[model samples]
Target: MDVQSETVPRDARHRVERTRARARYDRDTVHAILDAGMLAHVAFSVGGQPFVIPMLYARDGKTIVLHGSIASRLMDELADGVPACIGVTHLDGLVLARSHFDHSVNYRSVVVFGRARAVLDADEKASALSRFVDALIPGRAAESRAADRTELAATQVLRLAIEDASAKIRSGGVKDNPADLALPYWAGVVPMRTRYAMPQPEADLADAALPASVRRLLAADEAAA
Candidate 1:
């Protein structure tokens, strides 16, 4: 929860410094944003070619864990201690402008830079996977199917010790030019959100007791203001 600005990731997109804004500079805010979402884009340069792939991730204190097929080159390289960039963003709104040149979107995004390596400990891997499930649906993993030995052996799990991290957020009304304001054009912020409705159990499944964690998450997201 301590604010440590020194740990903020170095700006990757340095060209648009104006669009970048920093809030509290610490893991408190950073980890909270990460735990709230399920998707992350992990980017890395391999042989002078940069590739980005969106994957599901989970955070456990300072370690961020990712899982994928063992055949993935990106995962393989990362496990070899390759440098990587991890990004997570939450879209909040849209900026509607009179002219096409002034359109934009309001969002909260974070970019992290660090070296990643494979997690070998079985205990650590299980804990990471538990958090991954909890982040998505609270306690579904405990109540549902458990990964068997064969399944765990075939999966590749990677970990990144969070080092340099930075976050930027944009909110409120659209930032239109002062001249454009007087041009009698309609300009404003269109709020955006991720919403979920009541859960419809699987077609094959019967009326069964749902996990408390799943119910809690649905309540939370539904209650989000």
Candidate 2:
């Protein structure tokens, strides 16, 4: 698959049936959800046993990059080109409805289906690692020390092409039946968000200031807020 493509083609596996109205197949929507999420739950099977593990990931174009210890069983299995499913979700808010059965949480989520492959090339592996750090904090890779040969050798990077994917999102106010709305219950949405606190310098650093990358990240967060 060409990872640089514009959009992911949707099929049966990528379809969202439970809440079909919230399904989104556009590339922009899928990419936005993937970019906003920092963690993913990777699911796969080995010897008929299913395994799901949480992992940090970065999206580069149409591929998702993940890394782990070279000796890890999950990494080894994924590097071998096994089929996998990657899921990411971001909680937006809690919806409180007049009826308990009508309560729900607003969220944005994405599911990707693809075959994982090991990134063996030295340059490509290094680039993927850099992307991981930058994804957490923009411009961080250039501000920090580069990974040495020994460290790179101990790590394994895997790339999964975004071939079949879909995003589902639910937003805005509570949905309640007319009869339930007349009850003496409050209904509203409690918004939620993730924020970064002020950076604390290392204990060993006597008076060192925060790095430009970190400062920039904090500034961006504040601006967004």
Candidate 3:
């Protein structure tokens, strides 16, 4: 994987014309945004009507994997190689400005455009499912029991290659106009963050201690903070 590709080719569909200064085409930037995000919005058209659905996703090298029930309309449409757009965003703060027009959010976002197809191979599908679990919490898949044949058969997994992708980021204090700076209104950023709370155990497992995998996840969160 070329994390520092000289340039990511842009097209009309994936180009970021507005706020061009914030556009990032490097693979590293795009991958970082995608990896940090917990949810993604997948958009596609069905019968000429556009639909956007939120999904849990995992990035594998240059591709993204998403899973759902086998009978889902969105999964069925995506598996047919329909063109789709996947977007993930992480809000960092609220940027308050002196004027309403200058107020905005500090965020990192990525948009990927490609055609997705179902993962039909048993081995590939199983590997993708494991990746999905591990992506949420490292080593979690190894701690849990592997999915059985019937469970695998009931799920539909789709993979979309990140052919055309771009990340846009905005940070720092408010960008109020020079004239507005003289105003008496306060202008600054209110930082926001997401953290994991203490885990609740099942009532039946009162004797069982917290799993090492979960402890590791909590430790990682603390270290990050």
TM-score per candidate: 0.86, 0.94, 0.95
Predicted structure with the largest TM-score when compared to the true one: 3
Model 2 per-residue lDDT tens digits across residues 105-134: 999998988988999888898999999998
Model 1 RMSD vs true structure: 3.0
| lDDT (tens digit, per residue) of candidate 1 on 13-85 | 3223564354434566677777778899999888999989999988766768889987887789878888888
CA displacement after TM-score superposition, residue 198 of candidate 2 (Å): 2.1
Question: Which residue pairs collide, candidate 1?
Answer: 8-165, 9-164, 9-165, 9-166
Q: Model 3 compared with the native: what TM-score? A: 0.95
Better of 1 and 3 by TM-score: 3
TM-score-superior candidate, 2 or 3: 3
- In model 3, the worst 10-residue window by lDDT is 1-10
Deviating ranges (above 4 Å) for candidate 1: 1-16, 20-24
Best by lDDT: 3
- Alpha-carbon local distance difference test for all models: 0.75, 0.87, 0.89
Ranking by TM-score: 3, 2, 1
For candidate 3, write residues 91-124 as lDDT tens digits.
9999999999999999999999888999988888
